[model samples]
Target: LWRVCFRRKLRPRQVTGDTTYGTVENIVAVEDAGIQAFFPLPDFDRRTPFFGKGTFTYDPGADAYRCPQGQLLPRRKTKYTEEEVLYQADSTTCNTCPVKAECTKSDHGRMVHRSFYADYLDKVQGYHETEAYQKAMRKRKVWVEPLFAEAKEWHGLRRLRLRGLLNANIQGLLIAAGQNLKRLLAAGRRHAPCGSLLALLREPWRLSAVYG
Candidate 1:
């Protein structure tokens, strides 16, 4: 239910700002990955401006990982960040890997970085192939698709609002805030009682205030 992102210099150093999109297939390839599955992200690779993607994986055991080509990649190394341990794969194993040609050609090999507190993403993934996730996806069609239309037709958000990262971030937050408001209002209509509306409304502030 939270969104977090990071930037890392991509491969083929020759091409700056380029990135590889992550997919459910790639994520499920880890051994002991414990993840179930993921909701599919649209494959929008216009490749014109900042094309990137992220896939959520289901972690059943809350350990290990699998690759896209049905390769089972294991978590091999752990690096500590002041607050948590970051589990990464050993580059050597990735280098000598036959699947390396398809996964990542990075000098460091095909490794995934997971924080000590990232187990939630794994659990979410575990629900990926579930009947629950499938039903949720169906509901999402009725949930998200139309909201996007509202943003475009009502909020004039059909096109990019500004150029570069600064503007994009602002625009995304504005859209997200609007979406939260809509969801909250709809909840009231359903007589669902107050839920995470207030907390979600304050989440950005809370995360900024604490995570930093």
Candidate 2:
């Protein structure tokens, strides 16, 4: 969506979404295209330390991570995809540490997998900590989430009526049309219901036909 909008020169001020779209790839794509993305970071893995990644600091000069117990986790090797580098602590050193039991359950010691886009992700994490991001999140909650709620709860859009992908897309657009008509009616009731209803019925395609 952002890419299409960008190509059309309809540059948005910012992009916002829930956790599912708040990924490192999406954030980097938006930021690279010169747009600010407002989103919260996903929850950390439960298997990780309760202190989370905050307890593991990255050292760029050494290309290593400093564990909470002060052990260095050096870069071991790259994954098959080459998009991620695995950093591992020495098993001997980790096993001897007094806090070993609390630190890692793996006998090979704790490992941190760093992505090629880790730096971009770190910057986005900083954005997530800001008040502006929180405010945008609130706005998203009000504007975005309610549309789905109304579609599902009132418009019988809880389940897809069609099977194939193209058919499903058609169904989705129909539901969106219904929602737009509902909003138009609600607004029309205030001043010009008869004219608005006639205009809507007469030119429904006017609302959906434009490509750019």
Candidate 3:
């Protein structure tokens, strides 16, 4: 979609989606395309009882994370498959620290992960504070989510009746077309303006891809 928009000189200023599309790779790809990524990161530490990942501050000059206890967690290893670098505090230091109980239960030490694309993720995280991000998310909730809900509830989209990618794609396309036609007729009944409706016609693929 970004490429299509770029080629047509209709590049979107921001791309919004739910957390399912918030992987590090996707966030980097969207931002690298020069569009803002308005999505929440999958915060694995959100429910952690101990100090969360956010409690550790990164020091770029030293290439390490400073723990709340003022200990520097130096880079330990890089897991390429996971696309993240591990930083860990010294086990002996952690075991002896006064706040060790609040930090981690690991005998090895407190650990923090820095993604290969941490910079991009960090930038996207900052977008949470922007009004533009809030507006985009609001639009997504209103304009995008209901289409899926309606499909699942009324259009037999709860489960696939067909098998295989080709057949599934065909089924999805048909369902989206039916939904579009229904909306088109409803718009016609209300005598809606043509401008946005025509834009919708031009981007039918978006409906198929999104709902599918």
Best by lDDT: 3
| lDDT accuracy of residue 133 in candidate 1 | 61
lDDT string for model 2 (28-80, tens) is: 88889787877677667555664466679999999999998888999999996
Among all windows of 10 consecutive residues in model 1, the one with the lowest summed lDDT is 10-19
Worst 10 residues of 3 by lDDT: 203-212
Two-way lDDT contest, 2 vs 3, winner: 3
Candidate 1: list runs displaced more than 4 Å.
Answer: 1-100, 103-110, 155-212
**Candidate that beats the other on TM-score, 2 or 3, i.e. the better one:** 3
lDDT of 3 by residue, 105-174 (tens): 9989999988899899889999999999998888787777888898889998889998998788787788
- Residue 136 CA displacement from its true place in model 3, Å: 0.4
Residues 85-150, candidate 1: write the lDDT tens digits.
333346777677776665565777455555554554345446557676677566556655566577
C-alpha RMSD of each candidate structure in angstroms = 15.0, 4.5, 3.8
Candidate closest to the true structure, highest TM-score = 3
How far does residue 56 in candidate 1 sit from its true spot (Å)?
15
- Candidate 1 vs candidate 3: the TM-score winner is 3
Model 2 lowest lDDT segment of ten:
203-212
